[model samples]
Target: MTTTSPLRSEDRGNASVTRLSPFQPLTDEQQRLVDSIVRFCERHSHDGHAALVMEGDAGTGKSLVLNTAFQRIQSEARDRDSTRSLHGMRNILLVNHPEMIKLYRNIAATIPTLRKKDYERPTSFINAMHKSEQRVDIVFIDEAHLLLTRTDPYNHFRQSNQLEEILKLARIVVLVFDPRQTLKFKGYWDDAHLRTLLAGIPTETISLTEQFRVEANPDVMTWIRALCDGHLLPLPAKQHFDFRIYDDAARMYDDICQRNDACGQSRILATYDFPYTLNGEDHFVQTGSFHLRWDRNQPTHPLPWAERPESIDEVGSVYTVQGFDLNYAGVILGPSMSYDKVTDRVVFHPDRYEDRAAFSGGGRITDTPRAQCQVMANALFVILTRARQGLYIKAVDPALNERLMLLWKERG
Candidate 1:
């Protein structure tokens, strides 16, 4: 069933280069929280202050809040009188993903006050902290859960942890974090660990309950969360949100392509069940009759999978799809996941899991099988919530597929 590779080098340059539109209007809850955060920044513009942590799950407007707050703070700094004490304060947005940096930089280029350099990676921000004589006034970190610990190879300067170094870099630190989004073994930050790090400092923590993604349906989010936690099965329901179970992989892929053609943003995602090699060879994901290559390694571009047209034929993994959103997401449950008819629940097969690095190196971090399975579950949950409008799912296990079909019948 292997076919010719659909991704070509020529298709890379044909990607659309339209400027990012203005951010969606903030909800009333988001606006209220933003106002409070801005007030805190204004009061502690000069002094070294405690960090403010914003916690939320997938689809919550954490990115929206951080982006809006960064722009508002920059405007306030520019408009302040030169004689005022808070004038000329420097602020920067810190993130770990290179694609996210490029994405935000491209968006910032459209605004007059914002600069591309304002968005940076963790290592770059830490290096800048050592050179600059003046402390950064405000630092906003998106995806704070991805912060590396001392075990990370990127910690060349031997910093204790990312949180410690970031606190030293800025007086007013703002972190947007979700513990469930941590995909790698090196990502060590959590609620307990963060609280321990900020023991001596005064901190304010806020929780976001509203979900802006997945068609803004709370029921869908609840079901996804329950499924990830192994509290419920993958049952179908006739809810307001769009969710479907497909018996054929090819049909699911075809539907994803059609959605992309009509909506301009859609892709197929799969679990890391196939061996991933770094040698740049094409490895196809073959399930039953459906066969397609995994996403290619594009060295030059920021986010080739989402930006390029040919990427529509490639299947994206968690590493490529994380920290990004899509109009529709078609998820393929590979060999790693299965349904236990005896227990009547979903189970993860660790031996079949391909991302060995995520399980290795951290001897005590994820020792038990259940712990490793939880990480895999987290990866699945992240993929499921990437879609803003709809979700199409296909399971490879026969028992799982049959159960899904039965659930759909029950929904009627």
Candidate 2:
């Protein structure tokens, strides 16, 4: 049986575009990578090379590095007009998310040097590669883990994985990926698998070690990792990190609203416990006293989920907020996640989890209950790490709430 396409097309009717602020200055590691790419492009103007893979976790500034390199290369191309040999060098940045592609195009429109044509969705770029005879000099793929394999519905025309097709279209391909961020069945890229695919080709790997997001607090990030790994324990107190556990979901929602009013970048997110309405209508996620709908409409360009006014009252799922960040995050742990008093651990119910697409086919190595639990755990881990300055959480299960409260009290 053939699977249907997972990409949902939305109607974005003439939405007014907003200009985003300029990117932050790159860290030392990010700058070095950018410089190396620039030098490689200049040195290999005639002969093409293989691919370069950069592995980094969510908050390691991979996006920053790619954007900086893009801008720098465009500026250099314009300045080297006298050097006719380098004038024809072409490059493009491919992102897997549609909303992100629209967001980047709107941002690129404001800058005089940046071209909107340089940004595209991965599927569109792949189609273009098949149609055109010309090969792009370099292709930078963000969120490379989201690239689909041959089993995906979107890969109907191609017989091979996305990485192979991408390598055929460009001399130098740069991929920024993290295995833990793979949230769908079709996302088949991992470090070990990618290395094996590029065995004969020249490949260079770089790992980013510094934490640039989540308020740059290593202790808070450590605690988050532990929590995802099933360690239901209290975190050590830190001076700058803001972590709080709330008994009431309504109160947590109110706090998120207030944080957005004060700081401008806060959002409420929840697990895939509630099924989205089938008739294209919004469905409310009612947990305790708190009630809100999932983001019904696609957000307009320029202002993304964390920045849009409509998103303030709507709850985001893992798909919408995976590759984004916010100033503060209010996370609701729904019925799918619960506390097992007998085992003294956090447990996941696969039946209660609504994201059936994640486990529909036998894509996972072992499609057992334990594997499903790990997938859900990773989803929560992604949502928890989205906040830069603060994190607020509400557990719907009373037993889980009491256990968290006791842990918090012990830390005090």
Name model 2 segments beyond 4 Å from true.
Answer: 1-23, 80-86, 154-158, 299-302, 364-371
lDDT (Cα, tens digit) per residue for candidate 2, span 231-330: 7756657557678888887888877777876765677899888887546687888876677888665644565564466677788888777767777899
Residue 51's lDDT in candidate 1: 81
What TM-score, over all chains together, does every model reach? 0.90, 0.88
Predicted candidate 1 versus true structure: per-residue lDDT over 4-34, tens digit per residue: 3354332223122232222557789888878
Prediction-by-prediction clash tally: 0, 0
Instruction: Point to the candidate with the largest TM-score.
Output: 1
Worst 10 residues of 2 by lDDT: 1-10
Among residues 3 or more apart in sequence or in different chains, the pairs in candidate 1 whose N, CA or C atoms overlap within 3 Å are none
| lDDT, residue 36, model 2 | 76
| Candidate 2 residue pairs that clash | none
Candidate lDDT (C-alpha), each: 0.76, 0.73
